[model samples]
Target: MHEDTAYPLYNRPWFSVWLDAGGNITMKGILAPAIKPFTSDLLDLFENEKPIGTIDANGMIVADGEQLIFSTWMPPIPSAAFDRLTRSQFNARLGKNTPDQVTISVTEECPNRCIHCALPDTDNRESLSPDAVKDVIDQVIGMGTT
Candidate 1:
């Protein structure tokens, strides 16, 4: 494999920067094999200091000596949740008020506790009554989760 020197976006010697769609910045790989020997003091600097760089909305970034365009990944967020997050982000950035989606743990008692279940397979957990659940929903809605 050859390193593409033509484009230095993700080819930084030590660490490369990536920007996500939600306007979040993160480093690709801060610990490279070549820098393993000289990382004693560098590790602290990476943890405490924020990377200084300029990124524009056009997807262009200025880091080090050159300007580059970087790529980022976003894990699959469920459509409903993604819509809520997008709406909340837009409202936050624009100083607008909006209702954020509320996630309530209604029940932990699963009828089908399969072999590969994500939740704990405990049968002693008690589920909330329908009235209790409704009250919780009403309370959340009153708090602006509507």
Candidate 2:
């Protein structure tokens, strides 16, 4: 149910996805590149700016007995007729494997009353438990977030 529209799919050049040791799949990436007219309609649907389609293109859930396995998608070739340059581009981008930025809000409340803040509201906000904060910091550090 998470939705962020500040960044649109037409602006990004790449994305990165990975799964944590606890089986928690975290996908943090830039907006997707635009679709060209030459692209397949089926694949174009996957690249749409709408959340439903974009999420489908970026995420997957597999049912395995009692467990729900989750993962993200890599760039898919539209067809064998696709040019060699485009195929090589996909390979190069996918091979540029690195960690994306990890943003964790330890506290929703900021004592300062700054006018430039984007928070919907600053009052009576809930903060994460100390142990939870510690855990998140440790996890992000281990994941190599810069």
Candidate 3:
């Protein structure tokens, strides 16, 4: 399966430059904050180049035309609970976990034009019909999910 299918908002070049009010370029994502003017070297680095790097939830920065890119954030054992527990205990905890019973999307239609809303950007604007909603509730009840 494609990585994009497995993950939402996945881009081949997932990096986005943060810019200040003065139009000066800042570092990628939330990692680097200090703003600096885009130099000729920086422009060259961005073009016709797949700079070898790993950009995770915490982003990264490449400067001075270097091949070896570094991650801004280091993942610690994949989970915070790992630091306090043994491997066996961690496995047991996960094995004993219960998944969420149900997820109900009540409506897709919204009247408000909120600036942050992604719904307006999507093609789908139809909401579930009253009968369809009733059927969903009935099915949920039959499955013993609240």
Candidate 4:
């Protein structure tokens, strides 16, 4: 089981999800404008000593002069069992929690036309499958490893 957090559900493991005090959820693209490296140690956010928006007494997101409105809270990725998913990205396990960066190169087909090549005789060349490797990279980057 993952650790339960009291910080009102503004999680980044999945894309931005902002749940307010009235049980409302907003799936705004909050990443770009947000303070980077969200330490998750505070209930509020700030920018240049100015309160951008957020952290009401009940942890509701308060955008000045703007009424937060959204009828439904949709998960970025839908799930099968639950009618509503929480902020933990369905509790998906994370990669190593280290300040580490890695570059991964995947080889699809044998380059050398040797006996070890499965289809050496034919002209078979395979490039990196981006979609296939994206999930891996996402998980890795999610761990705060660039």
Candidate 5:
């Protein structure tokens, strides 16, 4: 029996040992998984405490240090509350002559047990009401360019 027959869904490059139709065990493919080392000097660039030269879709990169950059985009906030917080923060920062981007954590009820999470453990979690959230949005838009 081929190992592929036993685990048809396994598409990884390596294969495991399996028994043949005659009940004899045989090595069907590579016994151990292959370890592909990083081929570029990119890893070394980051290792030396340097900033990334360019960030890919996943943000991995190699670059010179001391480069100042700013980016703003919609963050992962609840659909209902996203616009308000985004606008408010944008306005506040703009008023100070330094517009800062904001990233609001809409849902405090995360399932993961991360050690650094700041959410309160109590069942009685407090969140913004729909009407109040709308008010915040109105105030933000009333301010100015975001």
Candidate 6:
């Protein structure tokens, strides 16, 4: 059994029968009969046009035969770091849509003391207030839209 934690589900030993262009069934491996019924149900669920069951708020597999294609929890609101990452990824895909952008780092609480840091090396570090951070984000968003 493939008991690796990385593949949370489908980490158990399962069999797959491959059929080539010609109609032929070749058994790959044998799994417990107890697992067979669940596997068939899962396949049916995925094959259907619409999802078979509902997904709970916590994002767990709440019901059998429920296929979860994609899920994400939206953060309370976008932080500067979050905005920057989103902008960068968007710019990479849609270069024409994204204008040339500059970033003003709001804080320097980096744990790693990189030698080439532009900020002064002092144990005492200051961060922008919540209001100041909000203003900076608003300005950036305005600039981005223009």
Inter-residue clash pairs, candidate 6: none
How do the residues 98-142 of candidate 4 rate in per-residue lDDT, one tens digit apiece?
Answer: 533455545546566667555666664666687867977778656
Clashing pairs in 1: none
**What are the runs in model 2 whose C-alpha is more than 4 Å off?**
1-100, 120-124
**Residue 116 lDDT in model 2?**
69
The lDDT, on a scale of 0 to 1, for candidate 1 is 0.42
Mark the 10 consecutive residues where model 3 has the least summed lDDT: 1-10
lDDT of each: 0.42, 0.37, 0.36, 0.38, 0.34, 0.40
- By lDDT rank, best first, the candidates go 1, 6, 4, 2, 3, 5
Show where candidate 5 strays beyond 4 Å: 1-95, 105-107, 113-117, 120-124
Residue pairs clashing in model 4 are none
For model 5 the TM-score comes to: 0.26
**Tens-digit lDDT string for candidate 1 (1-115):** 0112222212355664333332343444655444434433423323323333334344355343232222122111222333343445445556766566555556777777577
Choose 5 or 6, whichever is better by lDDT: 6
Where does model 4 exceed 4 Å of error? 1-99, 108-128
Top candidate on lDDT is 1
Query: How well does candidate 6 match the true structure in TM-score terms?
Result: 0.27
Question: Tens digits of per-residue lDDT for model 5 on 22-99?
Answer: 223332346323211321221121122311132334444323212111112432112223344444543554464322
- lDDT for model 2 comes to 0.37
What shift in Å separates residue 118 of candidate 3 from its native position after superposition? 5.4
Error of 1 at 41 (Å): 39
